[model samples]
Target: MRIAVAGGTGVVGRHVVAAVERAGHEAVVLSRGRGVDVATGSGLDAALEGVDAVVDTLNVTSLREKVATEFFTTTSRHLVAAGVRAGVGHHVLLSIVGIDRASGYGYYRAKLAQEEVVRAGDLPWSVVRATQFHEFPGQVLGQVPGPVGIMPRMRCRPVAAAEVGTYLAEVAAGPARGQAPEIAGPREEQMADMARRLLRARGRRRWVLPVDFPGAGAAFRGGALLPDGEGPRGSVTFDEWLSASQA
Candidate 1:
């Protein structure tokens, strides 16, 4: 199978590319580094020329609804249009679990918009909603700059990016199923604890201050970000990820 991975240079996208190659499939990476911009539709048609399926892991670093929504919607439409032109069969999207349940968070709204675009498109598609990655705490830490890191009090079942990548590759190899079972970690964890543990593992002495994020994102504190009961689970734990990162 020839699979094209949008944003294949990203954190999870890299693993998806490796997973596809390990399964004896051709992995074509679509990214700015590869001279393919899904947002502007530049080089997309050529990159997706022989693609059998397309796995979109594209992302933007924006917390504003307008900015995030525009990015996801535009990129999704571009990918679907180009995929259709290339005769791509399946379109797999990596989305967040509980996006529909969450309100006030712009990022989740953007993801929902992206999903809607994919579903409304003509191509056969699959939506794989995965919980936050184990490395999410580190990402959060990077966003805040100070001696004390402000960690949001939220509930999440964080999974490993590699595991999610493997699942995405498997999905891309098969027929589109519309919506796949959500993927999450083995156990639910608090976002603050994850941040503290991540800092400890990194040998950083900064204090983590747990605070409630204002506005619609505060819904995350009430388990709006958690996966449902029947979703698939990843084996790697937060502790395991921290230990590996330290080593």
Candidate 2:
């Protein structure tokens, strides 16, 4: 199988590419760096010339609803249309768990729109909703400034990006299931605690402050972002991830 991975150079996308190759399948990367932009539909038709399946892990870093929604909707439309043209069979989309329950966040709202676009399209599609990645704590730390790192007071079952990648690859290798089971970490965890542990593992001494984020913070704190239903869960814990990062 020849799998085309949109945003193949990204964090999770890289693992998707690796998983595809590890499974003895060819991986076609679609990214701006490779002259293929899913958002603008530039160089997409040719990039997906012989693609059998498409794993869309494309992402946009934005907190505004309009920007995020536009990016997701446009890219999804382009991918579906191009996939149809290229005779791609399976269109697997990587989405976040609890997106339906948490429309307060701009990014979540955008993801919901993306899912809708894929479902409404003509291609055979599957939606794999996964929880936040283990790296999310570190990412949140980087976004905040000052001597103290502010952590959002939220509960999450953060799965490993690599595990999610492997699951997505397997999904793409098979027929589309429309909506696949959600994926999450083995246990629930506090985002602030994860940040503290991560910092300690890095041998860095910094004050980690936990605070409720404005606007969408309530949704996260209210557990609207946690995974629902019986879904596949990752074995890697935040502690294990921290230990590995130090190695």
Worst window of 10 by summed lDDT in candidate 1: 211-220
Q: After superposition, how far is residue 22 of candidate 2 from its true place, in Å?
A: 1.1
Count of residue pairs whose backbone atoms collide, per candidate: 0, 0
Clashing pairs in 2: none
Q: Point out where model 1 deviates above 4 Å.
A: none
For model 2, the stretches where C-alpha displacement exceeds 4 angstroms are: none
Each model's lDDT comes to 0.91, 0.91
Over 1-247, each residue of candidate 2 has an lDDT whose tens digit, in order, gives: 8999998999899999999999999999998989998889999999999899999999887767899999999999999999999999999999998887777777788899999999999999999999999999888888876779998888899998999999999999999999999989998999998988888888888899999766678888888779879888899987887788788
Candidate 2, 79: how far from true, in Å? 0.7
Q: Write the per-residue lDDT of candidate 1 for residues 38-78, one digit (tens) a residue.
A: 98999999999889999999889888889999999999999
